[model samples]
Target: MSDELQHLKAAMESMRGELDAMKAALSRLSRVVCIDKDDDGVETVHIECTDLLVRPWSDPRHLGVHIGSSEEGSYIKLYYHGEEHAAKPAISLAMHADGEPHIQLRGKDWKARTDICIQKDHGVVAVLGTNEARGAVMRAQPGGGSVAVLHPDGQARAVLVHSEQHQFPGSETARPSTDLIFANASHDTQMKLHTDDAGSLMMVGMAGHSDGVAVTMRKDGPAIIMRGVEDASSIHLMAAKDMARVAVNQGWLAGDKAAASLAAGGFGSSIELNECDGTKRVDISAMKDSASVQLLDAAGNDSVSLSHISGSHSSLAMRGVAEHDCIRIIANKDAALMRVTGPQDNDTDITSAVYEGKPHVLVRGRNRPLVMAGEAEHGGVVCAYGLKEVTGGVASLAGGPVSGVVSVSSQDGTPLMTLDGTDHGGRLLINNDLGLQRVVLGTKDEAGFLALNNTGSNGVIACATPEGGVVSVCDPDGNVIHTMPRLKDDDDDDD
Candidate 1:
């Protein structure tokens, strides 16, 4: 009787172990079959449990369903809601390269709405979702937690998205290095721009509380964008290396260069170039409001090309043909120009330009029609143009308001140095070699002071300086032609 009982117990234990093994095998054999209503037949996929599911690419209205082993299946649908029948679904989804999920939505309509949610831990990528009835509307909300998207193509289109909250800052980022575009949306009464890297690029706030949208990039940055943000009101582009360093803001035909130091609203004024190194130039022909052009030279003569354009404003264009050359121009209203060539040497191009609503400007030339503004630390401005052009004890200055007296002196000035605040006069002091020096000011030229050697023979102006005991004159070939002593007497001409 005891042996029979033991045999019965062993048999039961063996059966239980077999059941457990069967359950594990069933779990590992699971797969998701992605089928599109537009497909020729039911396209099924047998995959590992860890692999992500993909919805067959199709129109926004096209439905894609996911079925898991031993569990119920879920379906994704598209919709639309906008004023003037403009609110429509322009939503699409896809799997990010990182194995996460993403959604692409465009608010092509004035006021539209849509929603997207993940019932599981899987990721998603949506390219475009448009309401078949309306032209093109991007409105949707992702109810799930934090997720990222990469939209290399959409970032070049400026497609609008409507969402409760998104994570894309258009400035300080590089995306879809391809055609122009990215992501635009209204959220919490402010319009926000989206990029591959969340908050790296952005657009100015639009009016009203509309759900915002998002945009992203694949892996690499694109090269040229034809009509990026063509439909948005204001768009901002920033460098990836330094989000706050260099940025360009443009919308409705106005362009602004910005630095990290300049306040948001303050950037609309003149440009502020603090610490930087390079050459800057501009051409007003391509600008929408180009009117007049001018050029300013400290000591040397400059050659410039001028033309008249028919826009509400005037513009100046320039090219950086030489290293360490500064270009400054003043114009009235907003304008644009083209570039003819790139900069010479390893120096960067800088422009010190302003739009004063006048009829004339001091700018002309271009290497390319597009302008690139970097960070404030690298010396860039918005609504203000600045370039680098300081050589031999001279620095560029702005013609804006001034504060307490700030002074910068050369090593010897080949002369002594002193400041007469009461008299409004200043002197240059030189102590070392005269390669290239820049005396900068926080304000414009009217209240600024600079002393240097290469004003293009303009002679040191208002500022005062001491004479060097010995002077040497060199020709264009860098050959010393003459030398004179400071204390030689008039009767010492015994040669």
Candidate 2:
């Protein structure tokens, strides 16, 4: 029994020594200082603490980076020496409630000046200025991004967006587009510049009224539009590869569709002015080798027209009540003519033309007398023709040796009577139906004489010589057979 007791005592002593060694090791491990060696044999020291602050030992107020934890989450705060309060940090990095990270930069007043945050949608957002009055915000997302500049009232003043798909402020459907928008203090859209798959556009307006100005560039061409109101006066300008046009609308109120327009294209160019009732009032046009100006009445009938065509005459025409009743003045390379036409086929024309290498004026009408006054073969002459035919009762004045003359013709154009001035004196003549002379009265050898003829050449004559009066009769062969106031040398004389 004594041997067993000695052995138990030795065992107890050995156990006590081991237990003391374990307690010492545990006490050393309980300290925060931890030292480790990595694969590269680099020694690293780690220390754990409830809070951390970095500052100059001589100035505790001048704190730099302070790291700590709160009931919410862990955070890191940055400070500047000139801060009024140590509790307000200039910068803060923290975890958001949605398990995302957020960073905030504060101003001297401890208000957040800027914030950079990761959103729950795995996007990034940055805001500038205090939370109460944000100045600007920039957001980037998986589908798109946006930058917005805000007014002091927190209304968006301008926004720039790039998106794979987006719904515009006033649009019903979403589309893929990039847009820059400007707004007024009232949150009204003032201007917008946008681009999409189809084209690009820029718009300007005021107080949410977007009809002020618009410019667009599309696949086909470009266009611009300006308006006073939504449905009021407007001007539109458009251009395509082959054509262009400008349109002006007075207003659409009161069911008025009146408009004016100017257009140009490969075919022609035209300007149209419309009346209040939408009737075409005036038209000016230029086409291939031709140009025209036309004035129209309320009924759309032509009132006046001026036109010029290459290789053709230029004309100014004024229309009357009837469609075919018009007066026209036309000028061409060959002549200039003025024509008056009626609804019937009746027309009157006055033309000044070059004929036979001489300028001439001709006045003619349908079924009316013709008057021709021009340079004639002898000299300047005036001719008048009767109705129904040019051969009836023609009269002419010639600037030749026989200056003044009057003539009468029968229906068949046979000379009937004539009174003319000769080189010597005045004369009168009468012709038969067969164009034969029947009577002649003239000054012969400075004496007044009258002669009458029959068909067989027999005639009677009476004359007043310088001395006295005389009478003579001629036989069929034109030989004088009787004479009054017989002469002394004549055998047949009766005294």
Candidate 3:
């Protein structure tokens, strides 16, 4: 059993990684768009996209695009399934105070969501992001000018910025500067580089750099080397269409000095992956406090989910896999829960909850109750179940350490028998097909006795009283019809 559970956990974790990789392909915000329409019916016509597309920026020289709303005050925001005004945007493209452009990527806007900011300042651009609200700000700044990316927590990450422009000593003309920077989601710099007028390129690792690789280049590539600044080691790589090889402090060919490639980059605060067929078949993502992986069939028929929740909790579930919730597992807070279903046609399933706490288990089969077990405040509990007639009988037994009752019923819903651990002592009751109690043998609060009843609603045919062992025969109205006085020595035979 333990091995099985470990395998289950491993499978879940593996699927989670794949889902995270697949989330990059998932598309959230839709493409349907409406042209401009103000309260006065005056409109500014713009273009529409199926889902999302990048348009040309105002300045053709810039490689980026600026998306804006035709309605002057209206925001250009990515929406959920709701109306534009009814829902907050997950992403928004807006402007900086100085008329430069800025883009903000937000989560659900719930108290726990995160945001990413890409802003331009003084001819330079930076990317910033963060996790939960009031968390640290991930900063990536440029050499030209600074843009302060706000974090709810008011803390900033590490950053690096470097640049160098070349100019002739006697002339005012200056060549474009070579700029290099590595920043985290908080916009903090990790590594910075600047190429000198001599064409020498240099890079240095900053305080918070996760990847310690650095590039130091001379005039030509033959002598250039990208090394791990942290350990002073070189890296090597070989690329191809179908496969590639990579390593640190290694080489692919003889005399090929190690060098950094375009692949050198920082990981964002959040990563998403999805499948390309466009059905959103799989999605995987990860963040500081949580991770989510969603899976769907190729046709997008249904989904399964495996996720890590706030710190200590995790869950795995299948919805519509064979029928909604065909399987589910949850573990957290010193408790574990599990559920498994048999098939879609029949509602046969078993479930357990609070297994480490106050445990309970329920078993069922297609409108039929099989068995249920749990714990009561005073003691443990067990139940017997059945259908009206198909399964024969249904019964309930409940009690603590002191008292309890076990009652059984017939298939047609008629009471059959009942045994009671009563205050007067043990008691037995037998009911007829009409559900009327026709036989009762027990000790009452006063004394022990035996009773035989009639089929009438209120009838006692015979009774034996403990007082002097008096026996009476009664009519349906409960009137005594005969009496037998106890002899001096009468044997008590009660069954």
Candidate 4:
């Protein structure tokens, strides 16, 4: 019996050895459980399983980390293990089928609240969500970066971007720029602020349009534009090197289809009002030395104009249907003149001026006479010349402090008649074609005298002296040839 017992014991020992050897072999082959030491003396424990759950030693139903793999790929998840055992993870880091890495943070209810991922195209992307709806997304790529805030429905409400190569809406080329954009629920852009190589720009969208107002600051200057529903209707304000301008455009409206503009610059300032078809209706301009306002006809001819020049003149002109026919009133430091002109250079001019330190008025007509009234060496004088006819005459009236004169002349400028205030009283003289006096009437020593001369220098005279009236005829030598009612003394001596 002792021998039998020893045999059984030997078999038991052999079986135990075989079992231990199998265990070692399986351990080496499996890779499921391993404990290794590196050359640096660092120890590492590796465990392979369908799922790995790490929990607190003291409490198995608490927060823990879970690492697992599935058809969808490998993932590491952090979750809670309570009586209500969570079905979903609070946080997950996964390698998806797309060969990308992704991280997700979830709410208590297991709804994803945030996600960070690396994409093939975009270097990195982060999305923040609320109630399963994306609230915001940020993307960073080699070419650019952007942050977009979304509506609950996933439409982007606002976006900010910094791009190395950004292409604008209608441009084929790309540029580096930074931009901020706001959108409506429909994802239509409502407002945008952008900066590029050229400068900065801000645009506000209209109800149905993307650009209702645009303000820009460029390398050259700054500009602001506000648009209406119609593309052609707008208001523009701009400033350049040394100039500024504001223009209102109404090409959409009939009758007055063009733009009206007001501008000011180093040289001057101006305003232009336009008519339909882009014709100029009115223009007002001012310069350092001159200013003018013009009203234009439909054909852009000046219908009327008022202008002024510093140290020069102010003039107002009105044009007729024919551009050459016009009326002009001009005033200068020395004179104020009004001119009316017609086709063929026909003109009439009226002038009031200070001539030789005296105020004067002149009226003249093209191919006609000139009338001048003014303060002359005498008190006041009015002179008229007949310019229409070659043989026309001239007449003038003059007044002095104590005397006045009326003169008439022929076409050759020879005096035909003259009525003048003499030292005694008055004198009247009539001349012939040779400018020789033919008749004379005058006041002498308080009496009246009349005389008539012939071409031969013979003359007849009548005189009213204090005593009486007498008539005498004289030869060219001043000798009395005959006498009617001869002088009393002479008659007596002769008798």
Q: Which candidate number maximizes lDDT?
A: 4
Tell me how far the alpha carbon of residue 14 in candidate 2 is from the true structure, in angstroms, after superposition: 18
Relative to the true structure, candidate 2 reaches a TM of 0.73
> How far out, in Å, is residue 405 in model 4?
1.0
Model 3 compared with the native: what TM-score? 0.37
Q: Could you tell me how far off, in angstroms, the CA of residue 378 lies in candidate 4 after the best superposition? A: 1.1
RMSD to truth, every model: 34.4, 6.2, 40.9, 3.4
Clashing pairs in 4: none
lDDT of each: 0.33, 0.79, 0.57, 0.83
Clashes of 3: 30
A best-first ranking of the candidates according to their TM-score comes to: 4, 2, 3, 1
User: lDDT by residue for model 1 over 1-495, one digit each (tens)?
Assistant: 989989998888898889888877765554333334436676556444432333435533332333222222322224343243332445535443444444444465623233333434533233333442222223333532222232333232244443334433675533331112233332123334444332233333333312222233333321111122443332323223212222222322132331112112212212222112211222122223333332323222233434454534333443334533233233434633232333453233334333332222223234311232322322332222223223223222212122122222332223222222333333333322432432211112234434323423222322212443344454544344444552345236543
Residue 199, candidate 4: how far off, in angstroms?
Answer: 1.6
Weakest 10 consecutive residues, lDDT, candidate 3?
259-268
In candidate 4, how many clashes are counted? Answer: 0
Candidate 1 global lDDT: 0.33
TM-score of 1: 0.15
lDDT of 2 at 310: 96
Question: Per-residue lDDT for 35-104 in model 2, tens only?
Answer: 8899999999987755788984657667888988776777889885644565668899987556777888
> What's model 2's overall lDDT?
0.79
Residue by residue across 79-121, what tens digits does model 4's lDDT show? 8556575555788999888888889988878788888887666
